[model samples]
Target: MTTNEFIQKLDGLFAAQEYGKVESFMLSALEEAKEKEDYGLYLSVGNEMIGYYRSISRFQKAYQISEDMLLLMEELQMDQSAEFATVLLNTATAYSFDENFEMALRFYRRAEQIYHLLVSPDDYLFAGLYNNMSSLMEKMDRNEEALDLLMKALAILKNYPDRQMEAATNFTNLGLLYLKTGDCNSGKKCVMQAIGMFEALDTPASHYSAALSALGEICYHEKDYEQAVIWYERTLEEIKKHYGFNLAYAVVCENLANVCREMERQGQAQEWLKRASEVRKRLEGENSGELHDIDNTAAVVNKEEKTVKTGGTKQKALERCREYYERYGKPILKQFPGLQGHFAAGLVGEGSECFGYDDSISADHDYFPRFYIWLDDEAYEKYGEELRAAYQKLPRHFEEFADTVMTPEAVSRCGVWKTTDFYHRLLGRQTPPETMYDWVSLQETRLATVTNGEVFEDCGGGFMAQREVYLSYFPEDVRRKKLAARLRKMAQMGQYQYARCMMRGEYVAAQMALAEFIQNTGSACFLLAGQYMPYFKWMHRKMKELSALSEVAGKLEKLALLPSQQDKWDEEKPERYRFALNTADEKVALIEEIAGRIAVELRRQGLAEGKDSYLEPYAAEVESRIEDPVLRMANLV
Candidate 1:
């Protein structure tokens, strides 16, 4: 049979949902084409087989066939053709599914190079390539690059009316990317659009269910438990309606159980957990990751039930450390009478517990009765190992807590260390930054880590002395340069690009611009308050505690969670258009209001000489106040 005739028969089988027959039929076709010496039919059958195997998650089989197909193409002197590029794209996707990301990227790039030579910019082939390659980029954590490629694919796909499903898939991909980057507004908008498109086209239920699950995820992260449960239930129903008790159904059931647990509806949570466990057992077997995850959720539910029965509240890890220290650590150190004055002990460095942010969830790893003991370099050389051994001999169980089962990464977080080495591990240097450039380059989070937690004792004052240097905040010049850079970013991302992207209908890009604006504005607030911003996870929590510009954190959070105006923007009704325009105006006004607040703080601090509400002029003024000519002359951002 000809390639077209074979493809028609394959499509008929797929449409009939005769999935069990697909593999054998495709293999027979492939062999028959090979026997007939029909290269076109053979390549066509090979591509079909690769896609079929990949769809069934048989990635090794798909990859093996892809290798065979490529070798055959090269042997036939067809290595540079569009057909070869198509095979390369399929191979790359197979590798990606198998989690061999670097190899996937290599194949993707080779295919992209061939496509650039053989295809037009707006070709549907290029769109497919871009869409597939974007998935690989996202998996590799190159999010900005992934976003750009997805946008390119969307732009090209928009020109092909028959490719609406592809365009909708791109929207789904874009939404997930935005969600990954914490741009929930854009993510929700894109996902909703994809769902709408899928519904209108009457596409496969799986496509619709996936989008619903994504929406459920967004709600879960936003703490909208009611809405999360709603979306997840709908997704579960969709999956059950078409796919029965499959892995997707099990996963959605698991998601609902998690949301129910978060809502404290333990009975409902247990019901969902049981459902998921039952489906997982039948569909995925006992050894599957899905089963393992369900087992974990069941364990957590049982733990919470036990906690409730005991009338106990989870103790903060820092408090536990101090109590443990008082009970054991102090007496242990007293055993080393000669070295007592040389030791400084505290719980600090590289854990949520150190920052006092640890919760019940943290106990799975690195949450134990642990604290650091710092010794002077010479004292450590003499007694560090001895002290560590003594520390290990302490009672492992205290109160309701015990020594945690630690991963390899959590081994050294607590223990005896030379004072210099502890700081070196965290900051990549034993001493504080000595130069203006060094201060500017030092990550604020690193400084925050160095200064966090209580120094329980410091008889020699060595550890605290070194920490004091970091606690002093940035020098005035370095602060000005950093503040100026943050202001410039706020101006560019929030005040300028946000509006520009909105006008261009690039809602995802607009949301990213706003997210950056919020981030930099938060950083600027910390700079203005003469504080180090903690890690990203804790920045908002710490910002709310700042005496200076504390209200700005709430405003930034409001801006981030604002609902997208995409529906109104696409609406033809005049009232809807007006509503979208009004929302857009409100958002811009909020952005400027934030800028205005920062501008006032700048003048109050005497870092800038401007009454203007716009941040760019204030940024320029702040840069001008930098006494260090080197930083003043450097790029603003």
Candidate 2:
């Protein structure tokens, strides 16, 4: 076939989604190029194959093709040529996606050098290089560097005003980076600018939809629920107008639902939730992959943004862990060939990181891209050490990450481990606990940690499936019993004792009572939702995720920050003390009001029944509803 006809045929097959035919045609063209000794044609065909392989997740083949391009260039004695630089850049990209940052960076710098020395600037290549490098730096927890690189990319696009779509993308990246750094104002500004640019230009719906969705995220985090709704609505408008029902549309729909739920507007939330389901059906029809999860509540960063590198939240850590598995661990196991099905891979432990609660501050000691490979008995005895060696030899620096500091219990983490031993260490028994007593007695926080985080694969050994069952939570009676006790404590501290302490002029004791009340209410909310209370660090943060009484969380936070009477007592005499006392009294009333709201939720759930405003009566009513004979007969406290 003539070259033009061959190119047209290849394009037709690609447009028709006939991947098999496209691959077949490309292979024949590649063979012809090699036989004709046309290095440029050979490289062109190889690059197309590389893109095809990457689109299909055949990353190993993608990297291999890039390697062959370099080999052909070297054989032709073409060093320091623009063509060689293109191959080098392509190879660097393949390595970057594989999370081998050291090699990727080396090649990227080399390619950049050649581009500067031997080639005129290609606007597309210049903008893309900086963009991809910024992404890599972001994954390394080097936010400042990532931001700098993105700005550089934006600078490049600015020179080419027709590249408005590319500029919008750069703006979106900047917005997300600013948000990652806790600069919500700057994040919102950049994202809004991107939205404006995308709207002005004839860009794809995704460009503008992403920008609007990011604004929604910023407003949601700032607790500007009305503004969040507006931003999310704009995103929904864009998606429906252009893309119709797709994953992004579903995501914005669900994001709107979450904001409405948080604002105590359940009817609106429900409407949006149904829209989300419909969008999911459309997304599924396109085989776009599994449905994305619910956007994480403020207690965690948005799961949709997990790939953005900033702090080390447990969610981010899990995402990083998955990236590592797919890039390094999975490929290594594939080399084992015959033994692939004899193992499982995931993160399992009682650590805060395991619970997806680790942040950048907590990550200072031990937290990053790490996971366990659990092998079967036979696999453990034979190939365990070899697999461990392979893992050790895998790329140590992924993205911008530095060498990991192995902790004291090094062998138990981020390496080849036996599944039985892993479970025994985390849960005190092999596999998951099978009895009610085992579930009840074990610390719920530990259980949450053990069952949280992603299991990339179980290699058909049933490990992932059983973990799913363990995550379904304890028996209904146990949840009610726990909720009842927490409710009783909240009533005693907030509804009963706080006001009494204030009345007696025991100012310090009153503050302590307020603190305890907030704690009880926070824990009670988690129990009410049948969720395990996370560690104390995440208790108040996670409390806001409970749609039952999440509005109370804001009040609880204000109560925690209330000034003790002494601050005013020392500054002035009677008047200041009176002012402090009045503030304390109002806080106590607010706490009680929130307690009543919790009582309302309990009654709605049929877990409590009473007309009494005092929380103690409602607590008693809830205890009476516990169905388990043993738990129901147990003491209220």
Candidate 3:
């Protein structure tokens, strides 16, 4: 095919999420485009390749390709073309995914400029730009700005004739905005309208699911648990049938679980809760922060008696928080009149009581009827201190809860923080860093320590969206890229170097190879987690709980300590031989465990988890150990 034809075809495949086919086709197509000196086709193919990289979330590769594409576009002075505008918008989206807000905003504005110059008055493309801009504003906590932009998009959508899907999306977004701003009525109106449009559209589209989900969210906020359950059930079914099970499906499951809990249908709630847990577990594949939420809910549903409840103090505290929310919260809403997304008050987790599961111990310090004030990262950054101050001024010394206080510093430390802080604390960085070691360590740390809060998850998607962003597996192409790298590393080091060291009687070096193999395999576990581990610690714990090597973390610890078998080494010693064999066996087990986890996570994601039939190939070189006695050293490195 001609380069332009090939580029167009590749763009079509990318839109279809056929990411796997992108590289092979693009390599050949790019070759042809370069050979034919087709600048337009070259730009198209380059941008399309960037999109493919982005969809699977290879941000670095996407950015690299985008830079090259942008330079080429500049070289050709092709920024005036509609295709170039679209490419700029797409590249901005790539930056947004990585939380590179500044760069994303730059590209988005540039695209808007180009789009305005290119498209006609009633075109729907601007609707998309506005929607995207609004979303970014929301992410940045620019609530008022986001709302204004959303309204503008709604206005534009209303003028468009053949943009039902975009219109529905706009309405849904508006509904969510209204819900966030405290205008539930307006939110409901917008959501139901969107749902109506979706039903009337007469096509099998994903927006119907999104609309149903939005309606469910509205019902949930209204405390209409029964209606909420119905909407959520429909959404769940539609999502599973049409989109299959994914992060969105998992979200509906969580909402359904919550609805069931609210309705006091403990049995049904438990069932749905279990389903939600499984979905969460499968999605995250490792324990994450949401584990505490699940554990608390499960405990409540299971009728486990609380260890401590001092004279209905808990209930009284909840009541006070609710009262404040109803009173002062409403007044605040009157001022904005568009806040409707989330309104909750609780002290569920992240306090002394949460971990202790008892109240009798101490209220000595700062423990009172304290409540969290949650806003999305964007809003929090802009108006968090103001909100905190406002919350503090609200009758802090209530009756017996006179010890109540809301210090600004305390609130700053206490309330739901920005995604950046949340991720950095959990994952060791604001953005997922680029490198295997960084990925592994971050996954381990994030999975190990995400839940330490009495989070007022007024952020609608809450744990759900966060899970998708951080915990969700790497996009396919990214996974393939990482997998290829890992395979290459393993082949070079594990398959070749270890055997060579053993053959050369380099016992110390051989042990080092074995240690390297274990570390690499452990790193692979992190890869699996990075790719599939969701935003909950408990889910990660569960995966580790299921692993064969999980029980042997202690053994591996000991293996790290056994003295090197160098000068006075005797492989014939029973204790040394036992340790060596056992260590080797355990290393094999660890590799197998990592492989198993990878396979399970991939299968859950509906991707091929692993091609290896067994873990033997990934295990330490047992044959080489036997042939070279000196190399069969124990715990050298």
Candidate 4:
């Protein structure tokens, strides 16, 4: 290609901001420049490539180019000139971009010396140098020196108003300097002037985006929120349309989200932050700090920090499990690619630890900062011990908090376990049930325990997917059967049997019947509410907390507190004879009253069809609603 045409093509690529194409053109153009023995053109084009690399944060390449150019200059007997100063300045800025501040300062001083030797202090080239150095000084907290440098930059830039891009950059840096010095008014004016200049131009879209961002910050500081929002939106649009989603786009998104939040547009604010998070995640994956930057703001109400600080909560345990999965569990699969999809790690099961109810006292035994890692039976046989050993290497104490005294029986409770046994331990079956009769006999407390906690990583999808099936609400027929069984037992023990024992003056036996009555009736109350009961120790407490039939809890409490009908204050009475309360009729009446209340709740729920206070009649109504014919044939209690 001809020289003029080739240079124009390179210019077009640079203007398009296509750095890959720019690099390619420079590589070919360097050969062409060398072939024609055009030293001036070669040096100029090489300088452009170096600046382009620095612009895109490719600092190493930019530094290498400067070294190559210096060698060529020495070989070609190049004179000391403005071009040499440009190369020095570009190299200095490249080092600064990489945060090699010491190296950057050395190059900047060298470039300053070269510029002073060859040019006036008032020249635009010298002006840009001061602006660049000011930024470095500002980062070092040398604010006074940074301010002096920016003022010097503006003094030179004001002499060249037609240098639109240069003037805009000087203003941006000066405004930032003023901001650093706490001169908010001066900062706003400088930033606003830069934005006005940038908006009036059509070329140098990056200058416009930068100027817009500066205006956004100034307006935000002034509390002119509407203007800040407008400017930030414009800057974001420019970045997306011209430069794609980069670091600048993410920053603008975060600022816009913050502004929207202060304006009480919570949903809009969270959405913007979420968009910013997604962009960061797409660009850098889990390796990016940018994702962490947006996480707290991106959620509408971030509770993680709150829950983490309140240590020993269930959330704390879940967080620990999640951290473990992200650390050891995920990395193990990454290193052993064959193990991917072979096993799963999570917190689950009916153990108190699984439910996160184990406090300091309860934690003395089986509680631990541990979770289960489940595998299919085949995987368990093949890689079981290997994977278990891997988990054993994890820090024994999570954050210096020791777990319980673990034993051989507790091994499968928290570590790598077979899926069949994991389910069977709590669920009493190998896999998910196939029929209504299977559901008929499962304990409700077991259901609650199995479904209570979080699952951290389900790579295999085998273990968690099975749990999903278990979480499904029981079939209408199975629910009715379980409800019917509970009702039948409550009626036999509390309503019929208790009264029968009381009428026979068997008050001691009557209390036993009353205790059975309370247990069965509470179980029925939980069934009627469609809630699984917890373990027996917490059953009464949990039942009282249920939204449905909770008042029945109060009645059961009164029954337990009542004095026995035939025996009272026997130790305080005569040695041969004891005092009697003769409250058998009152005790029987309370039993009937509690049982009748349950029957009333059942009929109200349309789970039964009866008006009698006796619960046995309602059991038949409950059984009739059983949709599964085979399950309906099962025994009531």
Candidate 5:
């Protein structure tokens, strides 16, 4: 086919979602490019397919394609080009997703090398590279180095104008760092500034949503449930209005339910709780015994009458877990005789019913006869295949269970593994080394917590030592970039346009700002999720498990429910809309406060020096430049 027709055909295939056809066509194109010695076309075709492979979870093929691209770049001696940088970044990210952090880091550094050569010192692109590097450092446990890099990105942004959001992001991250090190005041200031900027700029829903969510977390930690509930509510509204029944919203709602439950808002709390439960049921679809209700509440009983009955024991659950382990455990041990890792033989930690408290309700789900296999790095080196084979041989169907849920293969394979070895397989090392800056970003997220689950061994303490590594957190620079992007957009929408349009009765214009707000906030949440060790899709899945905050999922759904102008725009709809908006605003305020605290915390932790100014240095700088501090501070500029 002629080139244009071929291109048209390829586009058609892509539009049809015919992935295999797309791959085949692309491969043919690659071959043709090679024959023509058209290096640029070869690279382009190869790069596109590389992304396709990665998208389909074909990591090995993706890795192979990346290698081919790298070789082609080297042949052309364009290793320092943006094209090369792009490939490198793509390759590193792909590897990182596959848990091959070492190769990912190496390529990421190379991408940075090229990126630095082209971008200005203070540019967002440079900040992005620094951010990625800092994340890698956190994964590696080089906290000090990560901190230094984050500061460098912050310093660069400080000197650059029109970098309000970026600076705010840096401030927020700095706040996270402080929180990590137990420096609450500084962290609060930084996070507050970030929230302010996002609100002012009319950021996407998730940006404000994340900020508010963090604020709720801070409040929870401070034992301030009222404030936490308010922020959580706001976060819930934003996520509901934007993401539309997505997992992130569900999780946030679940979290909000927790805040409500803690604050004695049982009526409101139950609403959220019910939503969370429904979402989980939907997500579980066909029930899997491995599904754990991490934040689920127990059956309610009269507080004064049956406190003992209401408060379930962990021991009962343990017995069930042990029973399953015994039934299936022996066979796994026999299959992998070469195992010598930390948890080579049996179950421990969460599934270790012998060492656990029994909670009968826990057996409703996630409780099963399963155990994790532990191994040291050396045993994996010698007997990885045997271990894999043995683990895969375990029965998929378990008979004689109250809930005959299918056990996920991932968890079933768990009994034959060690925590450190697993991490090494997935994260390129046993642990991730995050900088103080990374910690700042991470404190706003759950990636670290998820990755930190159920460590099965500490043989020689090597695995435990690496716990400091792979501490899935965001880098300061990336946070800054995203924050800056939000600020710039928010300014174009919320502060500058929304109220004026509303006053003018220009509902469409007002709605546009709302749209802008939704987009920015949604992206922000994704950004927060991205910094951690979990894959993006998985993060969304886990978020939905939070049954308490499912209202956010409602809000996300509502965003797409646009009203027609021919009919007087539903006045009732606006009230419902305002509910979401008000909630989002509250969330924004909470997040901003959290960001401020983050700043204070970081400074106290010594990751950053005191700026001797207001809540945020960058905000103060902008405020100082504004002709009217009141108008500027009020977000009227």
Candidate 6:
């Protein structure tokens, strides 16, 4: 078939909404194009497939197809051509969706270079490029640069009367950007204009839904809960009609719940919350992979007799431990009367399950129905081995789930251990830190682990006393010193060095600076909340649980994951440096906003003296308040 005929057939299937059949049809077309040695037809079919997969949120497939297209383009020696540039733009978008921001920026830069060499200043292709590139810049927290490029796209799009949908979309984005930059009046005006355009054009439901949602967000921000509910309800209807129970539907439900709660409509708020939770649960369940039972009998019984089943309900490790203990541990301890009043039993240390954050994926290793039994040094010397032997003789299976096969090194995590030895292994000393230097040198994650989980029983009271000391959090002087150090790092890396690196076209260095800034900012937030930050892998998860700066976790995540504007920061083109500088300034403004929040918490806690949005002054103030001479004189990292 001719390429035109093939494309028409595909369009017909899409118009009919036969999405389930679309992938197979596209694959058949791609195979036919390949067999005929028709490279042009193959490219056309492949591009259509990539767009389809991306729309369906199958990002890995989209990315793989993009890679294949790029390889084909290279074999055809079409690197410098307009078609190659289009493919590069598509590939960059796929990379962005896959959260590979560095690679996304590299491809975007390559595409921009080719477009600069081949296209006119006012070409429609440049308008498309600017629109897509602006989105990446916005994701990267470069709001000012995003606004500029979006405006440029809107101006060029106005020259084409047939591109009203694209123009309206740009207006919607520009409004959101303006709101982000604190231009409330301009933001509302732009959004209203886009709403008018969308209504006039009778565009797809998603377009109108987005504009409604934007207005809903504005109303919610302005404390107009009633109006926010009205807008959000309208958006929810549109989303339900077009997209059903997808992520957008869940988000709108959450928005409505928040608005209802603010208006003190508890019943309505709970209804929305329940709906959102149900949608999210269903979505997560669909993606969690096939479930399997954990029967230890498979190891001993005949393989043919063991029935492997799918879709077993997985229990949290902590819950499983409690059940196992109730069924066997309490009875087993009764058999050893000498160990009765000398031990403390609980689950803690060295795993996500200890922090109550474990899921099914955690059961792959070092997970089982297990709990720690701590004994006083004398009690341990007298009966530790005997108690452990009794514990091991208990059943290996509970509720049809088997204990995980642990590595030799992990055996120490459970069973009987001398109380002193446990503290020594975790904190490197038998007692709590005595000096400010000692306190400051301990890893916050270690402190967090030692104090996490529940003490199911502590008849001896020794382990509980030591655990309570650690649970009291850091001394005031040591906390001040650590907070000061984190604040200094945030100021240096986020507010200062990140911008400097961008201006000098050190893209990789810019990324590193931003990463360090995020890390220190997160640590500072935990310190403000008077909570020890957990391990690096669980920091964001734990940050969400903090009462102070709870909202900051999402903002920090965005700053870390967003794609940088490498296209504008190209050192080879001196003309773009000014624009890159503006982008960097925009990011600095975001950093300052985060710093302002931190400063508010600091002032509230009497930890610093400052009305300044910059954190360096606050850092200095905090450091000066550290009364410990040694910590006060220590280097501020």
Computed on alpha carbons, the lDDT of every model, listed in order, comes to: 0.78, 0.68, 0.56, 0.70, 0.53, 0.75
What are the per-residue Cα lDDT tens digits for candidate 6 across 581-630?
34444466578788887886675444665657778999989989888777
Of 1 and 6, the candidate ranking higher by TM-score: 6
TM-score of 5: 0.39
Error of 5 at 263 (Å): 4.3
lDDT, model 4, position 333 = 58
Off by over 4 Å in 3: 1-81, 91-106, 116-123, 241-243, 266-637
For candidate 5, the clash count comes to 104
C-alpha RMSD of candidate 3: 17.1
Please, what is the TM-score per model? 0.49, 0.48, 0.42, 0.48, 0.39, 0.50
Residue lDDT tens for model 4, 332-416: 6566566667667788765655554555566666555677878888788888888778878877666534656766666666778
RMSD of 2: 27.9
Instruction: Give the number of the best model, judged by lDDT.
Output: 1
RMSD of model 1 against the true structure: 24.5
Lowest-sum lDDT 10-residue window in model 6: 290-299
Worst 10 residues of 2 by lDDT: 297-306
Candidate 2 per-residue C-alpha lDDT over 1-637 given as tens digits, one digit per residue, 9 for 90 to 100: 4566667887777455554577779889988988887666787788777765544334556765765676566557674787777776666666565554544665677778777886456456677678767767775568989998898788778788878877887888789889989998999889888888888874243457778888889999999999998888877766545434455667777888899889887666766665576455433342344434323222132223223223232235666778888888888888786676778888776456666566656655555567788887788888888888888787656663444556786556678877777767767777666655566666666666666677787784446655665666666666666677777778887776765676666878877787787777877776665566666777776666443355677887877776654442233345554444343455755776787677665643446656555677776777677667777777633
Q: Which candidate achieves the best TM-score against the true structure? A: 6
Q: In model 5, state the lDDT of residue 531.
A: 37
User: Cα deviation in Å at residue 191, candidate 1?
Assistant: 70
Off by over 4 Å in 1: 1-315, 402-405, 567-585
How much is the lDDT of residue 298 in candidate 4? 40
**In candidate 2, how many Å is residue 141 off?**
38
Alpha-carbon deviation at 333 in model 6, angstroms: 2.1
Clashing pairs in 6: none
